[model samples]
Structure formats: structure tokens, C-alpha cells
Target: MRDATAEKTETALDAASLVTDMAKRARAAARVLASLNAEARTAALRAGAAAIRAAAPAILAANAIDMERGRSLGLTHALLDRLMLNEARIEGIAAGVEAVAGIADPVNTVAAEWERPNGLRIQQVRVPIGVIGIVYESRPNVTADAGALCVRSGNAVILRGGSEALNSSRAIHAAFVAGLASAGVPADAVQLVPVADRAAVGAMLTAQGLIDVIVPRGGKSLVARVQSDARVPVLAHLDGNNHVYVDGGADPEKALTIVRNAKLRRTGVCGAAETVLVDEAAKDQLAPLARMLLDAGCEVRGDAATQGVDPRVKPAAEADWDTEYLEPIVAMKLVHGVSDAIAHIERHGSHHTDAIVTEDAAAAEAFLSGVDSAIVALNASTQFADGGEFGFGAEIGIATGRLHARGPVGAEQLTTMKYLVRGTGQIRP
Candidate 1:
């Protein structure tokens, strides 16, 4: 019999070595990608989309194995949904890749140019971020989206997906590699970790020079861990503790439609509203909304005012205010008005996405300006907080940070700027 301790140690070493090799390959690939022409990058994306479409059957088959294992492990229904894949979803993934191909290339393009009085010409040009490491959970679609965006933006990527979706991610990654080959791009430009060991994630997080930036997309716990532990710089996709506020001046019909849709529309999405706040002046709107939620098979947790309006509502815990249910459960509360609603959101929101439904322009403006979340909406479902919805094709993730990237992170957001100076031998005396 093999020594279990020795076997585990060997496996750990293997995972670490795999990550190191992948990172080095990715760094070399990134240099090639950064020097490649934009048109070639777009071609690779288009080819990848076609490859994804062609390999749908194999991908779906691999997903079935993941689904079986996921069920055996008793994963939550929401997580299972995120892990599940069908032909339609495969088609969507392919279409998303193609959509990314349709976007204008940002790399090497001059965003700003000026001539100084010193006879020096300066230009700020967009460039690839080089190598990116993405550690995501559950959603296998991220494997395709993140890889495509990186390739489109002329960067190389190394992905470490959740163990539960390893098979699915591997299948998708194979398709991407095929596309890269077809387009004459470096095959290593889009690589995924072949192993399911958690150690791979650690290797990636600490890969500072090898990885230009790290993007984490998953539950708050996962992101918090990556943010706290990673030695490399990070682009965090924090919790989707989103909110929807119905102002006193909101149109009742619009409020009902947007609010219901925001929460009920594929509750697993990061944009789903976790909390709903109604202005006390519009207190009459609360009961109808609560009744609609209850009728739609959604659980409602409410504060005192909310409970008074609807006896069916369960008493809300204080923690519910900051929760990201990611299910058909929502918290309801009543605020004095827009200010009060804003205050509640500022205190409890995850700075991801927030929406306000109102016919009053002033109230809408106030909510829009006051709320500091990445994506803010007026009279629309928070579900619109998507990269594809933002017309950027597919997103790697929604970046909630206030730095180089925010909102839906697409190809343009993946690039950093560089300065090019042209001078006629004028020395700075």
C-alpha cells in the first residue's frame, strides 16, 4: 500500500509545480500577446467562439459529470444552477465570445495626445495588462469569459476554477486552446489549471511578477481570503450585496415591475437585489410589493415597518441587511425617503450595484449621484449590471474597486495606459 502522507505530499508538490509552470508559460505568452496585432487578437476570439460552438456536445457531457459530483456533495441549489450547463447556455457562451470579438481593440490605441510648449509630443496609449490570474468559483462560464476577454485585450490568462466545475472548465479551456491554434495565436495564451487542488489557488495568489493582476469572483468568503492573503495586486469582485430603492415619487407600476424583476430574475446572478427599500411616504407601495413577492414563491424578511404591513413576512435579522442571499430570498424595509434609503444602502451595500425606481427626476438624480456603487440604475432591474448588458460583450467579472477598473470588466477595462513621448532632441535644461 502507498504511504498516504507521502502521496499527499507528492500531490501538493505537483500542484505547486503545475502552477509555477503555468505562470511562466503565461508570462511568456503575455509578452507575445502584447506584441501581437489587434486584428489577430480579434480573429482569435472569433475562432474561439466557433470552437466553443463546435465543442458544445463534449462540453455538455463534461458538465454532466460535474453536476453529478456536485449533487453528491450536496451543493446548494443556487450553486448547482451556477454549475449546470445546457445547449442554450453553451450557445450563449459562444455568442458572448463572438460579441467580444466584435468590440474595437483597445490595445495600442491612443486615448489622448498633446503637444507641450517645449516642442514635445506626448500620447497616452492603451496596452495590455500582460498576465492575469483569475481564481473563480462555481460558475464555469467564467472560464470562457475571462479567457476571451484576456485574449481580446492582448493579455495572457491563467484560470483556477472551483473544484466542483473543474471538468466543465477544462472542457471549455480545451476549446479556447483550439481557437488560439486556429488563429495562430500562442496556445499558452489561455490556459486553465489542470488540477483541482486548492493549493493551485495559493500558488496563483502569490505569483506577483508572473501575474500582472488577480481577479477573484466568488462568494464573499473567497474574495475576502484572496484580498487578504494574496501577495499580488488584486482586482476584487466583492459580494453582490445589491439594493433596490423605490422612492416616494416612484411610479407604482414601474416600481413593481423593476423591483420584482430585479430580485426574481435568475437570483443567482451577482446583480440580483438582496435588499429592497421603499420610502415611508410611499408606504402604500410596500404591501403590494410584499404580496407580489410572496405570491411569486419568494421568501420575504422585513423590518418592523415591513412586518406591520405584511403579517406573512418573517422577522429580519440585522445581518440580513448586509446579506447576499443569491436565492429567492430578499429583505424589505421602509425608509423616510431617498436620503434615508441612501443612508441604508451606504451602510449595508457591497458597493456593487444599486437601483432606484422613480418618475421624479430630482429623486433619480440624487440616488444616482449619492450612491457610490459601481453600477447604478434608475427604473431598471439591477440584473442589467452585466458586461454584456453594458454592451461590452462578456465580462470577466464586475470589479467593485475604486481603482484602475470598476463596473463590468471587459477588454477595455483589462488594459492599462502607457505614455509615448516624441521629441526632436530637445533636452530638458
Candidate 2:
């Protein structure tokens, strides 16, 4: 037994060493990626997509290994589901790469220009943010998404995916590197931290001086740890307890459709509707809407007033208002008007996405302007809160941070600006 334990320890040590080595190589490859032009970057992205398509069979085989392992380990059904990949998912990954190639490259653009009085001109130019470290869980698609975004934006990426998705990520990473090599870009432009050891996260969090930014794209516990412990700046939000408010003037039919789809389309996504709010004047319309949600197989958890209308609904505890169940469970409430809706959102929402269904232009405008979040919608399903849907191709994640970037963080949002000063011997006093 002691010998077996020691062997396990040695394996863990080897895995950690491999991860550190990969990080170093990625750091070096980033320098080469940072110098590529728009043409080279686009070519690389296109090649990457082709490579992914060619390797779809191998990728699926790798994903199958992950799925088998996850199932054998008795992981949650949701997690096991996330670990499985199919033909369409592989195609989706390739399409994501192609979409990114179509978007405008962000490097070397003059964002702003101004001339000083004393023969000095200044221009803010877009530039790469250097090495980016992304730590995420169970979605293999993130590997392709993060790699394509970073390369297109002229930044090198170090992706640390969940252990269950390791083989899948590695297969995808191999395709990306091959594309980079074929396109004359540095293959190291994208690297995966290759380890299952939990300590790998510690190494990434401490790579502050080397990695410019850290994007944690996973559950609340993962995001919280990154936010609290990382030496580098992190862009993350703990939850997406998104809401849909059906205002008084909202067309009841339209409102019901949107709300049902938002909550039931894909319950596991971050943007799935966790709460539904209705204006007091529309309180009478709640029964039909509740029936719609129920008919769609959603379990409604509602406050006292709402439960009175839908006795089948479970009584919602106070904490349900702010919970991100990430399931079929939805919390609902009734509000006085748009003001109350906004107030309720501000208090319980995760500041992710909120939709307002109303014909009143003034109320819609106020809600759009007043609600401070990454994405705000007018009479749309909150499930549309995705990078692909927004035409960004694929995103690192939706940023809730007020600084640098927000919303779907595509290639453009991945870059930062630097001032270029052209001066003719201008001297300061």
C-alpha cells in the first residue's frame, strides 16, 4: 500500500513538472505571436479550423475517453454530459474558428489620435495584452475558442481546462499548433497546461508578472478562488442569475414565449433565466405564464404572492431570489412596475443579462439605460446571451468587470491600447 501511494505521488509530481514546462514554452511562443500581422493571423485561424475538421474523429475518441472516465468516477450527470463531444460539437468548434477569422483583426489599429500644441502628436493604438491565462472547467469547446481569440488578437494563450477534458483539450490544442506552424506563426502561440494536479492552478495564479490577465470561465467556486487569490488581474463573475421582466404593456403571448424559451432552452447555461418578474398591472397574466413554464417542464419557485396564483409552485425561500440554480428550477416574483423590476434586478441579479418585454418605449429605454450589466435585452430570450449569437464567433467569457472590457470578450476585447508619441525633439520643462 505504501509503495502504491508513493507511485501516485511521483505521478503527481511529474504532472506538475509537465505543466510548468508547458507554461514556459507558451511564454516564449507568445513573443512570436505578438509580431504576426493580420494576414498571418487570419490564415492561421482558417488553417486551425481545417485542422480541427480533419481531426474530428480523433477528437471524438479523446472525448469518449473523458466521458468514460467521468462516468466511472461517478461524476454528476451534468458534468459527464459536458465531457461528451459529438460530430456537431466538433463542427461547432470549427465554425467558431472560421467566425473569428471573419471578424476584423484588432492589432495595430489607431484607436484615437490627437496633436499637441508643441509639435507633438499622440495616437492610441491597439496592441496585444501579451500572455493570457485562462482557467476553466469541463467544456472542451473552450480550448478552441480561447486559442482562436488569443491568436487573432495577437496574444498568446495558456489554457488550463478541467481534468475531465484534458485529452479533448490536448487533441484540440494539437490541431491549433499545427495550424500555427503551417501559417508561419509560432506554434506555441497556444498551449494547454497539461496536468490534473490541483496545484497547477496555484502556478497559474502566481504567474502574474508573466501572464497579463487571467480569465476564469467556470462555476462560482472557481471564479471566486481566482478572484481572491490570483496575483494577476482577473475578469470573472460569480453567477448569472439572469432575469426577464414582463412589463405591463408587454404582449402576453410574446412575453410567455420568450420567458419559457429563456428558462428551458438550455438550463445549464449561465444566461438561463433564474428569475421571472411581472409588473403588478400584469399580475393577472401570471397564471397563464406560470402554466406555460410548467407545461414546458420547469419547476417554479415563487414568493408568497406568486404562489397564491400558482399553488403548484414550490414556496421560494428568501435565498431563492439570488440563487443561480443552473437547473430547471426558476424563482419568480411580482413587482409594482418597471421601477420595481429594476430595483429587484439590482438587488438579486448577478449583473449578467436581463431582458425587458414591453411596448412602452420610455420604459424600455429607461430599463436599458438604467440596468448596469454586461448584456441587456429588449423583448428577447436571455439564452441569446452568448458570443456566437452576438457575432463574436467565440468568447473567452462574458466579463462583468467595469474595467478594460465587458460583455462578450472576443478578439477586439482581448486587446488593450498603448499611446504612440511622435515628437520632433519636444522638451518638457
Candidate 3:
């Protein structure tokens, strides 16, 4: 009989082999994808959208299974909402795919061109990063978005979704494959692992040469794991421990409107505001702000000052200042001004998204300039931090890292650049 250690080693070996095969196939497909012209790739995206629309019933059914399993596993209401799929949501996904198809192709375009002193012509051209692996959780929509974005940007992708989302992801992946097949694109160009094993995630992380970059779209724990263990570089989507500051010079109406939408528009999203910082000048309006959120069935936790303004406002713990709270809950604090608000956000925020609501242009600019987040907003809802809202169709995720990509990762951001040169033979002086 095999010993436990030996069995473990064999399993690890099998996982590694599986990842290696997938990566090799993906690399070969990427070469084909990179060679295809813009029209061909666009047609593939259109076809994928059509396939998704055609497969909506099957996709819905698959999502139903996932939802059932999620509930059985006792997933939180927020996660269950993310895991659920309805007819409208499926159509929205299809529309997003079509929207991506309409975006200008980023491949092979010259970003800049210059002439050298030696009469050599030089051009900076955008090109695919090649073979991207996406790891995500809950939302099966990512399966479609990541695959479409990678294909649109002329790269092959390997997707490893969370176990709770396996069935839903498979259905969407089939639609993507149909789209690729219809366009005569290699089906291997967009692959989703068949298993739900954590071993698969580890395999992708360690498959450095095989996968160019790993883009992880999930909660903090998953991103942390990928960051710590992956041999490949990671594009991290951070938790939305976001904030909105109601500046003292703020217009009260706009402040109320933006704050309400930022916090309640969709609590489960990464852009949803988790906290609010009110300028002490807005102290008179504080109770009204607390009341608005409370009326919307949101639980408001606040500091002593905020709690004093509204009896319904619960006392906040220090940890509340830093929590993501991806639900109908928000923490409120009073700041002296834009500077104090900026300090609070800098200290506790995840640097994902932050907004300042004020009619004061000076305060707005200060907040925008001071907060070093992926997305900074002025007099607008933090929910506006979406890629679609940014007119990029669908995003892989909001990258908080200041590397190759930040904010919404669209097709253009998915690519790296190369230098193209044309030179006449000139002897050195």
C-alpha cells in the first residue's frame, strides 16, 4: 500500500501535469490568436455573445444547480446573490459580450512612432501578453468576461473558477467555445478546468512559464494566496473597503444622493462604499444622512459623534473602519475636512475606490489628488467605478496594483507593448 506522503506526491504530480498540458495547448492557441486580424477576433466575440444568448436556458439551469449547492454550503446572502443567475442577468452578460465586440481592437496598433537621429524609424506597437490565467469566485459572469477580454486582446486564457461556481462557469465556457469555434479560432484559446480542486489553483499559480500572468478576481483571501504562492505575476483585485467623504463645502443634496447610491446601489459589488466620512461642517446634516441609509434597510455603524446625531446609528468598532462589509452595512465617521478624510482613507482603505461628494471644486480636487486608489470619484457614486460605466464593456476586475494594469482591465490594458523598428543600412561613425 502507498504511504500518505507518497499518495500526496502522486496527486501533486498529476495536478502539475494537467496544468502543464493546459498551458502548452493555450500557448499554441495564443500564437494563432495573435496572428488573426481584428475583424476575425471581433467576429468571434459577436459569435460568443450569440452563443450565450442561445444557451441562456442551459446557463440558467446550470446556475440553479450552483445556487442550490451554495445554499447547501451555507453561503452568505451576498455571495448567494453573486452566485445566482436570472434571465435578465444572462441577457446582460450577453450584451456585455456584444459590447466588448464593438470596442476598438487593441492588437497590433501603434501607440507612438518616432524617427531616430540615425534615420531609423521606430514604432511602439501593442501586442498580446499571451496565455493569461484567470482565477475567480462566485460570479460565473467572469468566465465569459475574462475569456472574451483575453480573446479580444489576442491572447489565450485558462480559467479556474471557484468550486461553488463550477457548473455555472462550465456552461458559460461552453458558450465561449462555441463562439471561438464559429470564428475558426482555436477552441483551446479559452479553456476552463474541468475540476473544482484547490490543486488546480495551485497548479496555475506555479505554472510560471506556462501562464504569463495570473489575474485573480475574488476576495482578499484568494488574492493573498495567489500573491504569496504564485510563481507567476498576479494582477490583484482588492477588496472594496471603499469610502465616501461628504466634504464641508459640499452641496447637501448632492452629498445625500451620491452617498445613498454609493452605499446602497449594490452592496455586493467591489465598488460599493463600505464607509462614509462626513466633514464636521456637515454635522447639521449628519442625522439626515444616517436616516437615509437606515430607511433603505442598511445598518449604519458610527463613531460617538455620528451615533450622537442618530439614536439608530449603532456604535462602531475600530475594526469597522477597515472592514469590506460586502453587505447592507456601512460605517460612518466625522472628519474635520478633506485632509482628515484623506488621512482616514489612506490609513484604512483597500485603495480600491473612494469618492468625495461636494460642490466645492477645491475640496473635490484635493480628495481626488490625495487618495491613491485605483478609482477616485468626485460628486459621484463609488458604484461608478465599473468598467462598463468607464465604457470598457466588461472588465476582468479592478486591479489595485500599480503595475501593468490598474482600475478596470479592458482589452487595451490586457496588452503589453513592443518596439518595431525599420532601418536603412548605415555604417557607424
Give the number of the best model, judged by TM-score.
Answer: 3
Q: Where is the poorest 10-residue window by lDDT in model 3?
A: 6-15
Clashing pairs in 2: none
Worst ten-residue run, lDDT, model 2? 11-20
**Cα-lDDT of candidate 3:** 0.92
lDDT tens digits by residue: candidate 3, 70-111:
999999998998989999999999999988999999999999
Clashing pairs in 3: none
Task: Give the distance in Å from residue 305's predicted Cα in candidate 2 to where it truly belongs.
Answer: 2.6
Q: What TM-score does each of the candidates earn?
A: 0.97, 0.94, 0.98
Report every candidate's CA lDDT.
0.92, 0.88, 0.92
RMSD of each: 1.6, 2.3, 1.0
For residues 250-306, write the lDDT of model 1, one tens digit per residue.
899989999899999899989999999999889999999999999999999999988
lDDT of 3 at 274: 97
Better of 1 and 2 by lDDT: 1
Return whichever of 2 and 3 wins on lDDT: 3
Error in Å for residue 319 of model 1: 1.0
Off by over 4 Å in 1: 1-13
Which segments of candidate 3 are over 4 A away from where they belong?
427-429
